[model samples]
Target chain A: MKDFEALKSIWHDQVALPKVSHEDVLKNLRKTRNGLASKLLIEMIGMGIAAAVLIYVWIASPFTMWTTHLAMIIFICCCIYYILAMISNYRRINYDKLLDKPECYINHLKKYKHDRYIFNTRKYKVYSIFFTAGFILYFIEISFMTSLWITVMGISFTFLWIALCYFVLMRIYIKREEAKLEEMIQNLERLHKQFEDTDQ
Target chain B: MSKEAQFKEIFQANSKKIYHLCYGYTGDDETANDLMQETFMKVWQNLDKFRNQALISTWIYRIAVNTCLSYLRVEKRQAKDELTDTIIETRGEEISEKNEQVSTLYKCIAQLEENERIIITMVLDELPYAEIAEISGISEGNLRVKIHRIKQKLTELYNRHERF
Candidate 1:
């Protein structure tokens, strides 16, 4: 039987060549840091641009109906809410407290995962409801101005699109996000259990 | 020294052991390399904030253990048996006899519990037992017991792989 010492000798006898150079690591560090920050930055910028355009439309358009103005306000609020949520999420995941003990880090990850699940499911539901309500209110004014067939077509198409999003797209997106979060949670929990086992 | 220079020194000192630790956990060279790089990236990011209360190596090890534990790519992680097969088939000719033995050793190490794998790799690297305990967040006495058990498990696995 090979003793532990023998195994240690074997382990030491093996040579490890560094596959990644220091420069490569530096390059990757810069790239990854910039990549995550830029992605979030782009998202926030997109939301800002969208909100700005909507405000401009609200100001420039000659809509006499109060419903249209309310719709525009609702749309702008959704954009602002989305931007704030994205910023919060970006801050949540980009934390620098990675030097915490394993159990603490695991707990941190579990909390983050829990928060993400709530945000993805419950928060998304709220956003969708508000968005659909805004669209419905907006459609009331359009229906008054347009022909009956046109209004019917427009309403049907909008509701169909909303139904598709609420039923199909949102479900798929939530399922994918949940799967990813669930896997991370499971891994963290296992590690947490391992730590507890050691403590015991 | 500049931050980059300081980081280079730290990386040069710890990267190899970190790679071995990751390799022991993953049993795959490419994955181990990726993990080592990732560990260093975190180290570089947080280097300025590092206080001197603990050894730099210990801090890096904590980051590495956390990184390995939190890695969620379940699909890319190969089972021990599959890893052994892939090693034999792909690098069979390219690897030397000693390298083959080392690979088998890593395969055996991969068979242990996740925490056990990390602990034993540190042990093999001859890290001070106190430092290992600190990095693993366990009492040194408990760590010794865990190491003894892991060594037995790893030896049994290594012998079994040898026979096969």
Candidate 2:
């Protein structure tokens, strides 16, 4: 090997990174998308507390026991609704693949547009169904006189928010593609310039 | 044993290689370490899906490359407001000679188009083309040509600097 190649080879061979302890790796692993589950568990606990509060308030109110029964039934249903949502979200979290190869997910986005599109599309469908169902369930639970208007407004806002988010994401993706093309062109120009100088 | 313990064992076995792959790409210890940690953090999170399709090393390499690429993107965005001359000059003062050479090589690497650099480096690391094709999602023939061109460029670069 020539001097530079020798140096480069030695550098490549001898330079090694030390292993972080198994303890640290596990600690970090525990914090991975496991945070999402931890969050859901926390949310579950919060929902339980909220449900308990609803029960306590409903029963203590001077209203009839039947109304209290209705309130308790509503609380139970809401808890069930959230539990199902949490499970669905957890299933879709990609926790297993993510822990093993977080960068693969990002690389897939940068290198494989079709895969990213497929992923985003699937996630969109899942989110839309979950949000729509939650909204419908909540709409059913509300006993106010203007509940219909509230439902209409609430549903409209959800759809509008989703549309706006999609619009912004598409714009960002388009801009990134444009920037990447521009960079490629500039790189090619520089490479050409280098060749031209060498020829001279 | 616990899933976390299993993950820890795997990471311990592979992280040094992972860090080197990261260092190969970034050529900076701090950035490489950060990328290495991020890769493992991601791996730890997704531990459940290490399907038998690919080796763990290949999966980690994929993650290392992806993290480096993302970091590059963010660095590019930051570059717009950066004092490029000052930053470039400062790099020489901070790093050792061998590291500086690696950094110089990486700077040259960045000038190549993204996939070209990726293919070439994977080849340099002596990974088989079939595995490279699998990781890059590029056909074997295309990867070969890209590697040829990248090596030609690097040789030209090395020759050019020799005259100085």
Provide interface RMSD per model, one decimal: 2.5, 8.5
What is the TM-score (0 to 1) of candidate 1?
0.90
Which candidate number would show the highest lDDT if scored against the true structure? 1
Model 2 error, position A135 (Å): 13
Off by over 4 Å in 2: A1-22, A31-37, A51-88, A95-200, B1-9, B26-28, B42-54, B66-97, B158-164
Among all windows of 10 consecutive residues in model 2 chain B, the one with the lowest summed lDDT is B79-88
Question: How do the residues B43-139 of candidate 1 rate in per-residue lDDT, one tens digit apiece?
Answer: 8888888879359999999999988887777575664755543333233455577677877888788788889899999999999999998888889
Clashing pairs in model 1? none
- Candidate 2 residues A1-200, lDDT tens each? 13435434634644345445556655665676488667888998998887788677666855443543554565566566767766765665443333223224443334444444544566545555555554555444443434677768876886677667666775576667656655544544443453333223
Off by over 4 Å in 1: B84-95
- CA displacement after TM-score superposition, residue B9 of candidate 2 (Å): 5.8
Alpha-carbon local distance difference test for all models? 0.84, 0.57
lDDT of 1 by residue, A1-200 (tens): 67778889989877765588888999998998899989988988888999999999889978899999999989999998998888787777643657777777888888878887788778888998899899888888888888989988988998898889888998998899888888887777777787888877
